[model samples]
Target chain A: MVKLKSNDDKEFEVEEAAVIQSEMIKNMIEDGCATSVIPLPNIDSKTLIKVIEYLNKHINMGKAAETGEEDDLKEFDEQFVNMGWEELFDVIMAANYLNIHELMELCCQSAADRLKNKSVRAVREMLKITNDLTEEEEQEIINDAPWAFEGPEIDDTVN
Target chain B: MEYGLIFLLINNQKLEIPQIILKSHPLQSKIVPKLTYNSNSCKTSSNTSVDKKVEEKSFATAEVATLMAPQIPSNESLPKLPQELITAILVRLPVKSLLQFKSVSKEWFALISSSVNGLIFYRIWFNSLVLWNPSTGKYKQLPDLMPTQMVTTGYCFNYGFGYDEVHNDYKIVALFREIRKHCVGAKIYSLKSDSWRILDDAQGEMLYDGSGKLVNGKLHWVTIVDGGWSIMSIDMVDEKCRKVEQPCYGVDQFSLTLGSVGK
Candidate 1:
């Protein structure tokens, strides 16, 4: 078993096979630094819990296809990332910190999907990002490439 | 009481507590609920510090975040992403979406317009053409140059699209036979000027058999003139038409087609 300690002092016990899915943890185990609880000063308890759940679920990823559980695993992954933007960002950070490749890809893809096909205003609202450009500056940008702004195929509203 | 005391001792000592004592603590369930609340408060306080560290780390190096933890943005209400993460998301978006969202901010506009993202062209319905940039999701439709009367005349048209390096423009060349007059006419459309100009010098008693092939700022077509096969090429730079002589004398005209060998 591997014990992971989150930033807020919460400890989680997970199987060695499952925890080894994290490249960072695997490296520590190889270096003999994993003898004690692995301290993750960057990840909080909530995000750590989410990361551990993902690691445990995807432990035997290679055997999933042979066992006919590929569709089930895909469904689980699809449902796993159905989180708010903030939570998704947290998961992305946690996954990056833990060096969990699959989780990082899943969260990043989810972030991209949410921003896809959204209008400028819609994207701004979704990300809660303020428009830092002045009206004239924005107009000049549109004028510089008028055809990019004139397409009828783009949606003006958020999806 | 023992578990609570041990937690206080660990906090004071800043030392790692053994996993066995944590798991064996009888009041672990009660302690977890209180810890959850404490962690929530701790998150709020540490978020800003963590964000600052992430910003410093990201700015200090241009390296990929391998083992180092990426800086999470501190603004909890708004999930403001770093420039690198935003680029990661932008590259995955379809070209159309990238174009529409270009007006979101100056950074996005610069990223989409930058030359790192190459342009792609797609032909729609054989009559109109759309040029798309996959990185920006932006597309521009070229103006239709084909006349309405030509569509119903049943005349076969051959088209050649190429870039003119000398003029720094894209040109679409169309050759169509005037069935009534038994003559062929060539028309060139310049994307820069957004207009088509007829090449009056190209009128000839020749038949264009297949599509034009573009090579080295020129368009080549197989033509049958006076029952003899010859290759006709148009130089996009000077807008001049010239015929390339057959490599061999008296080779059967039926077996010849215009093709490029190598660069």
Candidate 2:
């Protein structure tokens, strides 16, 4: 078992097979450097638990094709990324910090999919970004490509 | 835990690895510089209680979590996402959404503009070609082809645009057929010099007037050569026309069109 202590000082025990899915931890183990508990200063306990769940679920990924569990894995991934943007952001940061390539890709794609058809105003509100463009600049952007803003699929509501 | 130890022993072939690297490895030295021997003595009292309170709520829906995440006390308030993470998200967005996001902020405008890597080529009218980069908001209209009148009314007005990495230039290749004279003419436009030159060696009776498919630094077109439909390609570097070997399809279908998928 590999012990991982999150920034919140809460420690969780993960199987070596599951925890090695993280490239950083894998490298540490391979280098014979993971003798003691691994401290993940950038990851909180909640995000660490989420990442551990993903790692444990994905431990048999290599055997999934032979065992006919691809659908189960796919469904798990879909449910995994269905969390809120803030939670997704935390997961993304943890994934990045842990150097988990697949987790990073999945979370980033989810983030993009949510923001895909959002209107400028919706995106600004979601990110809490104040629009710095002047009226003329905004007009110029709309004038440059009027069709972009006229699409029926553009959503104004923030999730 | 016994299985994990056995797996590690079998993989590494060294059971003494733990003792040899203990307390001296980079994971201990670099990551946790203030490494303390007493794990039970570290900062855990207040944080564990706070985590328990948050955990009792269970997982909420995305909308509810978005409303609630900010309210939960963070040990370290969420930092602004790094630029690379933002760029990764922005690149996945479709072109239309990206354009709409230009008004979000000056930082966003610059990021979105820089994220756009390719140009858009379209014909507004007969023989009038415009190359536009929506990111940079720069566009150039090609000068009228020398045989604009003849090519405009021609039966075949096939064209293709692609970047030439060799010369670091953007080029447009067009094949025009004069129905009246039964003549096929080809022209190549160079964005670097802002000029067009006649491709005198381009030879083929085009099967259709559709645009050529750009692939592997070449513009490919379907043409009729000696009563058989063949694939012809123009090398963007040498500006020479060549025939590509066609796949062995049952020699019955005549309608052959050229198209490419992926980058």
Candidate 3:
């Protein structure tokens, strides 16, 4: 076990093999520099726990690694991202910062899934963003081409 | 997704997608919802500059991959390369790997998409299968075609592809059918145009003899055509698709060599 301190001064214990999945941490360990509590100023405990969970699952399943029936494992990872959108974003941000390649990929693909079947309005709402392009600019972009919305009735959809 | 579908149809030779379909799509970064009929949102943005964007996108990518990635020389191996390097690497990869890598990124989704079609890709055979080109880096999805006895297994299948040296046009042909009725005609794909079109089948010729092979400048396939089975050849150069009759003597009786009869 290794002790780690989060950004908010919370201390947590993580299994050595699991935490080492972070190549960043693995490099630190190989350098013989991780003897004491490793402090992670960038990651919060909430996101760190999730990352640790993933690493742990991966290592524990080193059992069925060869059969490659990792689909069930992949499904669990997918369900893990089924949280509220804000949490997903937080995890994604943390994953990117921590350089957890698998976690980063999972979050990006999840982000892609959210964008899959949404409308422009829903997209804006989901991302909590307003159009940066001006109304005139939006119209100008829409004016030059109209087939994109050629046959849709948006108002009737909600009503 | 309109542009995505257009790019796909362009390869399909489904009438040229109206430019409007491409003009209204948002970037992969910008995701809009499923398209409906009341798309007042889709107007504007004439994509006269689309070709320019494609050229510029290619240039910008090559610039990043070739110009930027190696120059920096970071101490740690970088996780990602410029999109252009990825595309170049993707184009060189076999279809199997590309299919798996397609799940990597949204940009990769757009880049590796089979939606935008123009490159001459694989030819279709019987049984919901298509012959694919690994060279250009795209796989074509052929419509569900009923299979014959010969092509039930993959080994019986063969693909004939080459450049017509006389005309400098490239062609792709796939043949695998047990019976003449089921034998698909040679489907011609041109590199310059990057589209597939059905060539006139060699009329009254059997297409399922030993299988079609590309030798010299013509396509050679065995057919149980005519009253009996015969070897047939098509000269892509002259657009002449005709049958070549087997000689007077049995092929085994003498050392019969296959030769082109005409110029």
Residue B27, candidate 3: C-alpha displacement in angstroms: 14
Clashing residue pairs for model 2: none
lDDT of 2 by residue, A1-159 (tens): 999999999999999999987766775676566788888776899999999999999999989989999999999999999997678889987776676767977898788888889998898777776666678777876766678888789999998
Interface RMSD of each: 9.1, 8.6, 16.0
The native-contact fractions of the candidates, in order shown, are: 0.53, 0.55, 0.00
Worst 10 residues of 2 chain B by lDDT: B1-10
Misplaced by over 4 Å in model 1 are: A145-159, B1-76, B110-263
TM-score of each: 0.47, 0.49, 0.38
Pairs with steric clashes in candidate 1: B54-B71, B95-B137, B96-B137
| Chain B of candidate 2 vs. true chain B, TM | 0.52
Best by TM-score: 2
Give per-residue CA lDDT, model 1, range B1-263, as digits (tens). 11111101111122211221111221111111000001110111122322343234333432322111222223348544443345545655665566566567644553343221021111111234443333333445555556656632334355666667787776777776632234777788787887889977666736433345556768777665654546778888898888876555432313233433212
Instruction: Write one digit per residue (lDDT tens) for candidate 1, span A1-159.
Output: 999999999999999999987766775676576787887787889989988889888989989989999999999999999988888988876765565657867887788888866667878777775665568767765564566556555555653
lDDT, model 3, position B95: 37
Worst 10 contiguous positions by lDDT, candidate 1 chain B: B32-41
> What is model 3's DockQ versus the real complex?
0.03
